[model samples]
Target chain A: MKSPFIAVSKSEFILYLREPSAFFFTLVFPLLMMLLFASMWGNDPFPGEEYGYVDFSVPAFMGLVMATSFIMSLTTSMAAYREKGVLKRFRAAPATPSSILIGQLSAVFAITVAGVILLLIAGIVFYDLRFLGNFFEFVFAFLLSAGSIAALGFIPASLAPTARSGVVIANIMYFPMLFLSGAALPWFMLPDLMKKISLVFPLTHAIKLMQGVWLGGHFWDYPVHLAVLTGFVFAGLFVSVRYFRWE
Target chain B: MTDNVVTVRNLVKHYKDVKAVDGISFSVKRGEIFGIVGPNGAGKTTTIDCIAGMHRAYSGSIDVLGLDPVSDSIALKRRIGLQQQESEIPDRLRLREAMELFSSFYKKALDWKMLLEQLNLWEKKDSFYSALSGGQKKRLFVAMALIGDPEIVFLDEFTSGLDPQARISIWKLVGNLRDQGRTVVLSTHYMDEAERLCDRVAIVDHGKLAALDSPSDLIAAHGGHTRVYFDASEGFDGKSLSLLEGVESFVNRGDACTLEVNARSAIVEIVKTLDVMGQGLDSFRIEAPTLEDVFLNITGRQVRD
Candidate 1:
């Protein structure tokens, strides 16, 4: 027989695909944002930068994909499952709680990776995007950024008691992070106070690390961002495991 | 060696201010269909939850297959199957997928394809869970519970929402489980289900076990009296039935007469009495005491919420 982890992960991945809203937010929405932003700001090079606007925007959009896949999609699904008693049913089986958690995480991570690949494809096809960074460094930074956000998602997933409240909690955190973190808007365009506030959000650091690494910089270049994101990953995991309710 | 597969001692559970299961005790023998029957909020489900290790009791001890349910929960889960009262699968999940996913959770699993077919879900294997009817969904959960090929199965309100035909089929399926030497513990509010399916029935009321015995024993002890009704003849004296042997009480409603008899043999005396009275015994019917009467006798006839 197949392992519980594989069985659960496969079912969750299939369920994610069948969910129209999750598919829209994770894949379609990101590509649409890329098209809209690229058209508005034209792909011309920034004042002092060699790369065009689309080049930097593509990497930053990867942060948006992580946020949506983890915060909005993953959190809501987990809470909904709890509300419907699916989690309680799973608990009655022989599978451990860790198996369910890791299985769900793997599925959401796969979706986030797919979303990132789609953005990359769109950038290359539509705007002739450039990449001067080391492929290994970019991949490493991408994984860290996505993993941190995915881990943080469990906080809201464990706290929300119902699916509707899960959406409310996710949206409460999602919109502000989207605008301030340079995911839906550029960081340089933000006012000084807003920029200061944006630094408090994990997505801001994610965008910084992803943009830096994608533009020929090593991950070690952003020590503060790396430390902040790593802290969030551990804290999120701790809280979720501590407070998670099966029913 | 004892054949008892489950034993509960002074089991007590409370939800904040509400007492869900209060000092309930019982034992389930192996290869028998044991039932916990009660009205809504009677703690039937709560007791099952405690024994199944789904809920930790506020106080008390539970041993299933000689393992403590609270401490040996994981090990107990491996050998027991549970179909919860208010649990559901993801709406988008297909029937086949749900089966396979649950089947993989056990060390040894029955063939999911055969289970699905036996449950009449093979044709709808690809149907989304939300698309199935309520009865089908119940059957699907039952199938998932059995896919692990567990030694013991706990079904809470297993056939509550099922139609008559569906309920009968599921009852037969449960009977087969016991015949195959698996201990089956089910909770239900349907008195007929308990009387027909269970080898022994536990009557619960207000979070306490009111009575526990076989269906026949319970019926004989507390099922009240058998009622015999017959159409009344014009100018017939109703006072005559009160004098008949074994007739505990008699009521006349002008058009009909009803006699509460203490024994089944009273029916023969009733017929002879009516014949002697020249009523000709027309429109005669006998209502035997059932488990429902047993419940009403022990728990009172007041409607429960």
Candidate 2:
């Protein structure tokens, strides 16, 4: 028997492939992002060592891809589907509505995993960035980041009326998180007040977790990021479920 | 009770201040092609919407296959198929894919290839929904509504903007549904169509049912006047037939004069007068009243003012 979830998941993946720009952003852009941001923070930005920016930013780029593909991409596409009565049609059918939703998530899930794998290879080969802490922290952080971003995607999906507006809403959400979460740049150079505000966003927590993993920072730092990301995951998922308009 | 497949009682639906369906009641018999005919905003759509479990009427009881659409919605919905007015299905799906997707909902489904052949959509099997023409889209919709093998189907304005040939093809398709013992509740504004296909019709206007019955019965009751055409035996002007009992209007056409008699009583009087005079009658035929006349009789000659 065919798994029902695979029906929607495979269909969504196939359709998304037809859009060249979305495919590039979800799959290829993360690598470019890793290179550009890694180069900017200094070819070797780690203190007391020669861990290149490629090494430092690779981990951050993993987290960044999770946010863009899982949260931003999922939310925008879902909003467009809602605007076009796609959700409405599913509601009428006894077919797998939830499976279709999960299918859309699966597309993001695959994209994020691919980006993570590429980042891992680049970090190993070029940057020589070692995993100094428990593998579980890195793994746990990866899952949480993906879930948190997926949940947060609901907010923009709820507010954006059309696909175009969804793009704008995502940009409004992403740019600030990119700059402040230390994904685009580190917060160490900012004044204390600016650094304090950055702490509020999940990006800060994602960054802090990865930064801790590299230096083997105390596990205590890991929980704070996890806690923030966990809280956001619940809130974003809840609001998205409550307000998602299917046309 | 056995004869009826659907029964709606005291159906009253209100939206804000306006009553969309006001205290209407009707029943559709099993395996019959029932039509509800009305103009735009005539409450036919609202009435069907309530019956489809899509809307909650303010005060009404709609029972389809002995189940209330609102209260027993899931059970009722599973059995009834609906085609929304101007409903746009999504793109990014093949014609066959759409059929497969919707058919997955039901325990028993019509065969996709069989349905495609019926709609003439088989050759366009690989085409996406957006690539289909308007008639093709309508045919696809009809196909989708039937794919689930619904016992009773509700179609709202099924063929509003189609070329004449497509319209006739759809009417034939609707006829086939009744032949297979499936009940269909159709709503359309086309009078000639309602007359041709409806086993029974509910004529609605201003949110109330103006008349309801078989085509012939409705004509017998409210269809008033049987028009007759005959030569007013020479030397007798059509003017000589002025103000006769049943004759509502008279016009002389060269040798033949047409008379619009008000009732069967007027026809008897006209026949007696013409026969007693012993004048040469050129030609004569009694024209039965149509649904349009019933509409005018009920709504008045003003045409929906």
The number of the candidate with the highest lDDT is 1
Worst 10 residues of 1 chain B by lDDT: B296-305
Each predicted complex: what DockQ? Answer: 0.75, 0.32
Candidate 1 lDDT tens digits, B1-305: 88899999899999989999889999999998999999989998889888888875469888899998888888899899998889899999999999989988988999999998999999999999999999999998899888889899999999987899999999999999998889999999999999999999999998999999999999999988999988887877877778878889998888788889997887888788778877866599999889998888887763233
lDDT of 2 by residue, A199-237 (tens): 877877877777677555654666778788899888986
What is the CAPRI rating of model 2's predicted complex? acceptable
**Model 2: number of backbone collisions:** 1
Candidate no. 1 TM-score: 0.95
Q: How many clashes show up per model?
A: 0, 1
**Per-residue alpha-carbon lDDT of candidate 1 for residues A1-247, written as tens digits (9 for 90 to 100):** 8899999999999999988888998899988998999998878787888888899888889999999988998789988998999998898888776688888888988998899899988888889899979999988888888878887888988778899999999999899999999998888899999999999999999999999988889999999999999999899888888888787
lDDT of candidate 2 at residue A188, scale 0 to 100: 71
**lDDT tens digits, residue span B117-205, model 2:** 99899999889888998889888888888887889988889998889999999999999998988999999888888999999999999
